[model samples]
Each structure stands twice: as structure tokens, then as C-alpha cells.
Target: MAELRTEEEQVEALKRWWKENGLSLVAGVALAAAGVLGWNTWQGYQENQATAASMRYQQLVNLTAGNDLDEAQLPEARALVDEIVDEHGKTLYADLARLMDARLAVAQGDLAGARERLQSLADAGSDNYVAGLARLRLARLLVAEGDADQALNVLQSGVPEALAAQRAEVRGDAYHALERREEAATAWREALRLAATNEQPLYGVQLKLDNLGLESPDLEGSALETSSRDTTSHDNRGLDA
Candidate 1:
């Protein structure tokens, strides 16, 4: 005859197993739920911060656009930007605030301050589009500071491909300042070739070419002569009277 275990024995074995492993399983589930809630809270906090920063930034923009910004208003704008940068430096709005600060510094003739802000942005490694603009503007400031070598170096080395034409133009200007005429001419030509039709001013490139002793074709005269010939032909056709 086989021996049979009582139902009580099976229930006790299950209780022992639950006692050993059940708490661990419950703890894991609790941790996962906490993690999900924490992530959602963090996301909501970020959204709220971004919204507030955007509103502040818009106010700054309106001040500038309305021409209500003076030296007094500059401080207010600066304070707001500083606040946003300190609180939400990782946000897109922070990058915009930095750019605005740089522009305001330039307008105030605080070139050194502007250069510093732009350099910081260029090195931020967060937003490449803004970084590219920062590098380009920094190069211009360096050029204005008579730091031709440093400006040329920045343009040549730091500029991204999207701003290559502008960089080449600035490089040409730097070369010209350094009296490297041949190099300047080459850079200008490269800039002309790389610049988009809407982005580049033809007259500016023509002026550069003229400075380099390159001849510009007299398109006006050709157009005038064609118009005269067309007028003469039209007049002849009407002369039957």
C-alpha cells in the first residue's frame, strides 16, 4: 500500500515557499512602480520648466521688438536669461537665451563679453546648430578685435559644414586684414562658389573680386544694347505709316 500525505502537509509546504520568495517578488514590483511614477513626475517638472522659460523668453523678445529695451531693460533681460540658463541649461530655450545675451552684449559694445558668451556656446556641445552660429559670430568678434590669426583659425577649424561659405568669407576677410592677398582672393572665390544664391550678396563678392584686380563683365551694357536693337526692330515694323 502507498502512503498518502495529508492536505495539511501540502498547504504548509506552499506556505514555506511563499514565505521565502514572495517578499522579494513583491519588492521588485514595488520598485518598478515607484520608478515609473518618478519618471512621470520628472517629465512633468521638465515640461513646466520649459513652458515658463519660453514665456520669459517671449517677453524678452517683445521688449526688443517694441524698442522698449534700454540700458535699464537690458538688465531685466539679462536676469531672465541668467535664470533660465541656471535652471534649464539643458533646454532648447537656454541655447536661445545664450544667443540673445550674446547679441545684447554686442549691441552694448561689450565685445569681450559677447565673445565670451559666444565661446561658451560654441563649446557647449549641446546644440550644434546654435554652436555653429556661435563659432561664426565668435570668429567675427575675433576679427574685430584685430586677432586675425585666431579668427582665421576659428573659421578654418571650428566651423561646421553647414556654415562653410560664411566661414570662408570671414576667413577671406581675415586674410585680407593680414595682407595675404592671394590667400584672401582664393578664399573669397571659394566663398562665392559655395554660397547659395539667396544667401550671398553678389555685389559683395564682386567688390572683393574687384579689389583683387579681377574683371567683372559689363552686363549692363550688353543688356542696354539688346534693348536698343529690339526697340529699333519694333519701330521699323511700325514705320509703314
Candidate 2:
């Protein structure tokens, strides 16, 4: 009779403990499970979004791959580019689409449209490489439009090291246009030096220097002769001017 009483007391104590803590323990487990499920759902959603963006960007690329786009195909290509820009405006794909859109506008003789697109990318702070490329293109267009001062201003805004050679060349063009011969020569010399450092040959810079009565050391006889033949025609061409 004594042992039975003791077992009953122990059973009662366990029941009381569970009654005090069971609901809280159950609730804590439920909350943890819910949190994990929510995080997995969010991860899945982001993966799906990235996949959709990649597919759309590939479609855009296919539409613009070749130089054989005829008049009828151009509108469709441009429409696709616009759609990517509208839907994925904050993505890298959208920035690339803007560049392609600008090129399309140039092809269609829409200089104003092209300029606007290029200027938007140039002024944006998102991607330094894209901004630098846009600045270079815009500067070239401005120079072609006879706005050399504006071109120079654009180049002065700064560029990536990868674009330094091209920028200097265009600066030379702008200076030449403004009749700043000394400045033009200096810019071209810098461009040539940069190109050499990059292991890229700037073929005509030396020719231009020669026209300016400047000599490049160790130029081959055949090269000098060939360059002289074209000096009169190419002296004013300026690198990518």
C-alpha cells in the first residue's frame, strides 16, 4: 500500500510539469518550422526570378546576334529590347539592352534617340564599364556632330583604365578640331604609349605624329614610306575621330 502511494505521487508530479510547459514547447517548435518553410519559399522564388531573367536576356541576344537584320526584323528586335528594359530595368541585362537599343537607333538614322540612350547610360552610376563605354560612344558622336568642345568635356569626365587609350585618342581628335595642335599631339602621344603598354598597336598614331613633323624612333623604312603615302589623307582622320 505504501509503494502504490509513492508511484501515484510521482505520476501526479510529472503531469503537473507537463501542464505548465507543454503548450510553450509546442508553440516554439511550430514557430521554428514556419520560419524554415518561409525561408525556403523565398529562396525558391528568387531562383525562379533569376531563371526567367536569364531566358529573357538570351532571347534578346538571339534577336540581335547578326548584322543581317533587315528592315522588317528591326522593329521586332527593338520591341524585344524595349520589353527587357521595361521589365528588367535594374538588371545588367537591361543595361546591355539599352546599348543595343542605342545602336539600333543609330542604324535607323535616329541620332537624337541614340544620343539620349547613350547619355542615360553614361550618366548612370550602376556599372563603371558600361558608363565608360557610353561616354566614349557619346564623345565620338559629339565629335562627328562638330561639337568638339562637348566631346572633350565628355572625355574629361573620366573613364576606366581599359578605356584610357581610346579616351586619349578621342581627346586628341577634339583638340585637333579646336586647332590646339600642341594639346592634340600630346594626347596622341599618350594614346600611343598606352596602346604600347597594353600590347595593342595603334597603327596610325605614329603616322599622324610624322605629319606633325614628329619622328618615332626605330620606325621601319617600309612602314614610314607606306605611312607617308597616306599621311595627307589620314592626318585629319584622328583615331576613331
Best by lDDT: 2
lDDT of 2: 0.65
How far off is residue 96 in model 1, in Å? 2.5
Model 1, 37-62: lDDT tens digits are 67566556645876897787677666
Supply candidate 2's per-residue lDDT for 90: 60
Every model's TM-score = 0.63, 0.65
**Candidate 2 to truth, TM:** 0.65
Model 1, residue 117: distance off in Å is 1.8
Q: In model 2, which regions exceed 4 Å deviation? A: 1-48, 65-69, 199-213, 217-241
TM-score leader:
2
Error of 1 at 78 (Å): 1.0
Q: At residue 62, what lDDT does model 1 achieve? A: 62
lDDT of 2 by residue, 1-241 (tens): 2123222322343354346555874565467657566756655654576577667767765665554446677798798887877876765557666766776776687878888888888898355666776787778778777889999989887577866876887788788778888888888878767766665434466666666675544434443344334433333221111
lDDT for each candidate structure? 0.60, 0.65
Count of clashing residue pairs in every prediction: 0, 0
Candidate 1 regions exceeding 4 Å error are 1-45, 65-69, 197-207, 210-213, 216-241
